[model samples]
Target: MNGEDELEELDEESLHDSEALPAERPNPLIIAASVTARGGVLWLPVAGLLALSGKKKAAGRALTAAAVAMPIGHLVSLVVHRPRPQAANIPARQALPEHPDSSSFPSKHAVTAAAFGTATALEDRKAAILVTPLVLLVAYSRLRTRVHWPTDVLGGLVIGALVALAQAGIGRSARARATACRLFAMVRPVLSDHSCPSSVSE
Candidate 1:
């Protein structure tokens, strides 16, 4: 099949995304060597350190977002039980790892990376900058590792955004409480004066 046609089929994960490498190259050796060569490895431990650094509330929120999103993605994986692309006649970029092999419809790593990114962004904009690319790389690594299709990574991205939004919404409620209190203070006296009964005007 031509490259474009191969991309369209679920047949190539049309549900999540298209995770194809360059159609020009096909060497397992090269794919393996380059897969983990980028920021993917470094970001995981750094994110872990950020998580374990005793920032309990933020960390809890982050973990919760990740916890919720990943299971949802995994549920998608379990129900679909989509075979690893490698098993389904696609050319796997690298040999599959022996451990933790199962359904890969949605990437957990991508979900966690996104959760981490969203949590960090709540505190530091620069940290968020560092996180965005790492999340993308982590997704790419899965493709090179030969266990998933591109759509799986894409699915993770969509799910991750949802997780981030949910986490943000919880925080938004907290902020609204404080904001409303401040806002009310400014208009409270006027409200009290206006609220006086009309008979008092005598």
Candidate 2:
């Protein structure tokens, strides 16, 4: 075929392929995933509730784990500055309603979910089972929304798990416990309920 005719044929094929692809639209799964991603906000309060419920040691570990992991995730995202799956030429719906202003190498949502669940598991395994599935769901949501690649979510999960484990270890150290006691004491009076525990204890 002549050059012009070949170009025209290729254009037609391209048009057909585009037409065959489904149009992007919101769905129940995507919506639910978005809600699950609010994991960041949801888990912190859960830790607080645990403290209020008198599970202070579990709450302290969970809170500490989350605090440590989230900042690491943010810093990693900044350092790596990787593009989102959609930006990387991967086919995805880009379904998230609002996009974050950081790199997609380690998904913040996945990190928070993993850190929370893992930390909770260290405190109480039964509770972890309930949390683990939710964390996995949030990770999957990052993939489904095209905000992250599989590896990105994996990296986030690893980082979060490691941080939680590290926190648990440190919590067991006498020096760390002393520091924690001082920290807790300083903050307890500021609590409106004045019911916040003054030390991490099982």
Quantify all predictions' global Cα lDDT against the true fold. 0.59, 0.68
Candidate 2 per-residue C-alpha lDDT over 53-119 given as tens digits, one digit per residue, 9 for 90 to 100: 6777776777678777888899998899876543323233544556565687787777877888889
Model 1: per-residue lDDT, tens digit, 28-134? 55454334423234444555666676554554555566666666776777876766664433344324333346687777666666766676677566556766676
Off by over 4 Å in 1: 1-44, 48-61, 87-96, 99-101, 178-202
* Model 1 lowest lDDT segment of ten: 193-202
Count of steric clashes across candidates, in order: 4, 0
How far residue 31's Cα lies from its native spot in candidate 2, in Å, is 3.1
Per-residue error (Å), model 1, residue 11 = 6.3
Model 1 Cα displacement at 84 (Å)? 1.3
* lDDT score, candidate 2, position 79: 91
